[model samples]
Target: MSEQPKPLPLVISPPRRREKPPRHLADLTLEERQERAAELGLPAFRAKQVSAHYFERLTDDAEQMTDLPAGQRVEIVQGFLPGLMTSLRTMQADRGTTVKTLWKLFDGALVESVLMRYTDRATICISSQAGCAMACPFCATGQGGLQRNMSTAEIVHQVVVGARAMARGEVAGGPGRLSNVVFMGMGEPLANYKAVIGAVRRLTDPAPHGLGLSARHVTVSTVGLVPRIKQLADEGIPVTLALSLHAPDDELRNELVPINTHFSVAETVDAAKEYFDKTGRRVSIEYAMMRDINDQAWRADLLADVLNERGRGWVHVNLIPLNPTPGSKWTASDPADEREFVRRLEAKGISTTVRDTRGDEIDAACGQLAATES
Candidate 1:
């Protein structure tokens, strides 16, 4: 009895907050908008007009908001719709079909968002956190450590800008609305749960209040935050859930995804299964193929086996070619190995596909460009 030790205390990491999120259009509720409009001494109707211009029309340019009186346009724009970010520089590849824009936040925090133009549909990849708290050795963003959790408005602003660019036919493949959004940018989205979820709501909510994007077209990715995964399931959102399962076994995942120490691979999959069960949307397993690191054919078979053990009709695998970060020893798997990895997964009845790389020429590896500037 004397030798028995006390149980380890449960330590919950507080969500990091460096600076307050600026009061902007995307961060406010419809009622809050009215309140802010009143505070600015503008009629409540002006709030609706501003919402239409910002959320639906996708233009924050005061001059462009002509519905508001000429003198009040700038005031309305400056009041509730104060822009949260400015594009620093934009780079392109694939004949300008892949565009990556680095954005400067009000607090001087840098984040990136990429818009990919395909003939069928356009997709935008946006950052949820400024840097990242998860110290995944293979990721460039993790190398710098977490700067701050991006506000819901900060996350939504990136899409609004992309939507505006698409509307003006700036991106290639002609003018089109953004058909998809992926939370696969600078940080672990689930780590900033509230802001990420709030952004999703604002993206999916109907017009004049939100971007009106389809919930199904949005994908929220996490590096296996088990509890958060379960929490997201209960949020009643129908969006797809993508788990960044870089490795199939705990032993390897513990190294590739540092957070795996808290939530093992099996636990991660179980949580994903819960998501699928709740939403009726299949879980996407994002596997970044590191050359000879986790790219072995045997590992692929093990990955397939693990997914198969969870049963079928609930999970799909997206095998990504690792985009080499500067000076990093990790690199993409050989083409032949990537093919074999896919073949092995499919052979075992697990649905899999090699993800198409975008913005490679521009070094669109999330925080890679910003890290250089710093």
Candidate 2:
């Protein structure tokens, strides 16, 4: 018998130092920006001027900042608003209306953001963490484990880049403003609670501080992090909260969302109810329809019952067809099962809709390409 080939030796590379310039406006709040500008020997008002260019004008090139002193424009831009996203690759589908970009960060870390342009609006999906800690068996990013929580600025910069790209008509179709933002990429938003909230503020604050998008236009999804859910409700922002409840029961949820081990289904539902009570904004329950796992008719009925008992008219169910990662046993539910799931929820007087799947061709379902590349 031929001898088996020797296994290839594993080679480990030292972490690459973060390259590119360091100034990132997304990392600072309005006051902090002013403070930094003052320390840099620029007037505090310069910070607001820079912020207007970034948030309102959606332009970063100092040359276009005609309002600033000609000589100081370059220094202000370079010292405070350095480039954060370097587009490494872009893949488009849905007739170019949906585009996914793989960006190489200053640290050489690969993260992705998707810009989906529709008839009336454009939405950008941003990342909260570099990888993920949830470790859901069916998820691509989770399998990679958590690298680190992205700074508030890093998270907001993703949106600004997408917004700028859209406004400049760099994406397919003509230029348009980004209307919505979703934290549905790469990492769990609630896991990086403080930074995610800070990013939200930066996105919603008016010009000279943030992108000026309405709070209602932002959606933050979590895998039922109970404490964070309560904390988010208290933040006084009315951004929609989406709970990624893959399974309705404790047993299956424990297997699918590992955090369910700490907070049971009952506790999670109660927390969801508390959020609604506090914010008066309808909570969105996101269920990914996995074939043969959480797609059974009984689970659907149970999901309806739980929502009905917890609170009525204060919750919406968003059914997502599973976007299977390569080599994963989990797959999307059949059409028949998906229809039945919706029917059961509607029967309970709960509002329901299937999420429009976009950018599938670009591995848009978070961390799939990054994991494969890594």
lDDT of each: 0.87, 0.85
Best by lDDT: 1
Give the candidate number with the greatest TM-score. Answer: 1
Extract clashing residue pairs from model 2: 26-153, 27-153
Supply the global lDDT for candidate 2.
Answer: 0.85
Model 2 residue 224 lDDT score: 81
What value of lDDT does candidate 1 attain over all alpha carbons? 0.87
Among all windows of 10 consecutive residues in model 1, the one with the lowest summed lDDT is 1-10
Note each model's CA RMSD in angstroms.
Answer: 4.2, 6.2
For model 1, residues 98-166, the per-residue Cα lDDT tens digits are 999999888898899999988888899999988887878889898988788888999999999899999
**Predicted candidate 2 versus true structure: per-residue lDDT over 201-248, tens digit per residue:** 999998878988999989999988888899999999999999999888
Give the Å error, residue 285, model 1.
0.2
